[model samples]
Target: MSIVWYYDFISPFAWLQWPKIKALAAEHPITLRPILLAGILDLCGQKGPAEIPAKREFTYRYTLWRARQAGVTLNFPPSHPFNPLAALRLCIAAGSSGAATEAIFDWIWGHGRAGDSIEALAPVAAALGIDDPVAAIADPAVKAQLRENFDAAVAEGVFGVPTLSIDGRLFWGDDAHEFALACLRDPSLWNEPEMQRVAALPIGAARQA
Candidate 1:
């Protein structure tokens, strides 16, 4: 089976889930898709968790706790919600390989560094063997690919990062990792009556904007 993981470097949850997703590569082909999380939020008319003060604090605390429990090293970059375009475009420039993706994630989440400007991404680009980080990421094709990835993710109904798409099914968020594995092991899990019922459950009230 092949799994497409839609991710943005700005997300700590995506960082936390990377190792587990890598482990899945042992048995399944994993595609690392780099996208702009900000674009998704714009398309969905939503605010990112960091945009909300309370949620921002909670998200940091919660992700930190989860990382500790999972024995993963996680340190927030100098800032949350930093521009991820440079990093995302760099991934495209580097061919979007698993190693390239992991290295970028490590730069941001593991090493706790910003990934916004050319200076911030220079080391990562050098490590990936790209002689000219600026020229590589400045290629029109690289920019277009990142845009295409964002559009494709939106078409796939992806509203968040750290989403795993497998066999036409999407399992979102780090918390859904185990559930994704279960469904992957048993494709029929989604066909259960309750699953179908909840999928079609109607909204009783709509909040007015």
Candidate 2:
């Protein structure tokens, strides 16, 4: 079965689940799609968890706990919510090059380096043998490609990062990884009927005209 993994570099959950996702890719055909989380959020008219003070605090604490449980070292960058446009564009430039893509994620999420600009990503590019990282980001084609990726992701009903789509079935969030894996292993699960369907809320309340 083929799976499409829609991911954003700035998502802590996406970074946390990368190892498991990569291992799953080893067992199945997986497509790594780099997308802009900001675009997706804007398109969906939703707010990120980090935008809320309470949720943001909980997210950081929970992320650290999860990282410890998983034996992964995760350090928050000097700042949160840094623009990841350059990193996203670089992934598009990499284009099926796994090493380059992995390095980008490692540099930001693993190393706690803020991925705000191309210059910040220079060391990562050099390590991955990408000689002209700055030029690559400046390439009009690269910029356009990333824009296209964002559009495509919005079309696919992706409202957040770390979404896995298999056979048109959408499984979102890092916590849903096991369920996605189960669906991949058992196609019959995909055919199961929906548990329940809730009617949409009334758009207009009873109007006394």
The ten-residue window of minimal lDDT in model 2 covers 193-202
Q: Give the TM-score of candidate 1.
A: 0.98
Pairs that collide, model 1: none
- What lDDT would each prediction earn against the true structure? 0.92, 0.82
How many angstroms is residue 163 displaced in model 2 relative to the true structure, after the best TM-score fit? 0.7
- lDDT agreement of model 2 with the native: 0.82
List runs of model 1 lying over 4 Å from the truth. Answer: none
TM-score of 2: 0.90
